[model samples]
Target: MEPTTLTTDRLLLRPFEAKDVDAVHAACQDPEILRWIPVPEPYGREDAEEFVLRAAPGGWREDTMYSFGAFTKSGVLVGSMGLVRLAGLGGLERQAELGFWTAKEQRGRGYTVEAGRAVSDWAFTALGVERLEWVAEVGNEGSRAVAQRLGFVMEGIQRARIVQRGIRRDARIAALLPTDWERTMETPYLPARTD
Candidate 1:
């Protein structure tokens, strides 16, 4: 899974580069981003360097996660989105977990949703992903809103599903299937009938 770029009407989702360190560090300083995003509380320049130089690239090289930094056409960093925990991409149960965080100033412009659609479509086609899941710690209305807008069906909640700063927290779970996007799957899904 080599790092690649995905484009939208207004965005260019690409792998993080060395120049993104400052912007990434600055964005993570937002209180809201720190609260909901699981980034280090006191995110520093070194951390940003690690992400841009190491972690993100390493994920792609290992085929474990695919991360993209969402930017405007004019090159403004708007957010970060990634598909982690890629499992069974070579098998029938292929799946991945979607995660993202928007810059505080760029919150309402629908960039995240646009980027999500691009990633989801890629996963379904290029990666053969059957299901894409989005999980947010409970109370993250913003994330939930984006997930809903991306057409992920609300599957319910998971108790103690995530640990943030070592504290257990409940999480809202949702999924987007190939059928949700009108993409045909090799193995058809049969939903249970409600009596």
Candidate 2:
């Protein structure tokens, strides 16, 4: 699938381009971003170049991931987001994982939330995604908060489900299903009852 662009009231979500390497490199330099995300410990220009020139486009070409660089209307790079780990594209499952990171100075402004909603909408409507999972290392409160605000129900922690920098870590897993989209359902749902 070719990479597509999405827009919100305050942001533009588009494919990363070579011109964005500098901005991407700068944003990845933040301590918070480096800590929470799995990028190289000391993110360098070469890494940013590889992401913009290779990885981003490769994922699109492979149809296994859809990554977008979120930017302010003025073209300032605000962060990155993606729908990855695609499954059941041609079957009944239809799911993917949602991941994102915000620029250090851009935190707490709701930009990520706004972009997230737009991306989720695209995944549900354009990509036929039924379930969008969000996983974050257990202690990443900011990520968890964004997922919760976007209405992903906290499904609990998965033991050692994540590996970052070669160390296994527990992850908080959450999900947003089709039924949760606009409080409507594409297919009828009869959730099991424990009572």
Top candidate, metric lDDT: 1
lDDT of 2: 0.91
Residues 76-136, model 2: lDDT tens digits: 9889999989998657778899999999988999999999999999988887788899999
Best by TM-score: 1
Write candidate 1's Cα lDDT for 1-195 as tens digits: 778999999999999999999999999999999898888879999989998899999999999889999999999999999999888888877989999999999989999999999999988898888989999999999999999999999999999999998999999999999999888887779989989
Instruction: Show the lowest summed lDDT stretch of 10 residues, model 2.
Output: 181-190
- Give the whole-model CA lDDT for all candidates, comma-separated: 0.93, 0.91
TM-score of 2: 0.96
Candidate 1 segments exceeding 4 Å error = none
* Weakest lDDT window of 10 consecutive positions for candidate 1: 180-189
User: What would you estimate as the lDDT of candidate 1?
Assistant: 0.93
The alpha-carbon deviation from the true structure for residue 80 of candidate 2, after best TM-score superposition, in angstroms, is 0.2
Residue pairs with colliding backbones in model 1 are none
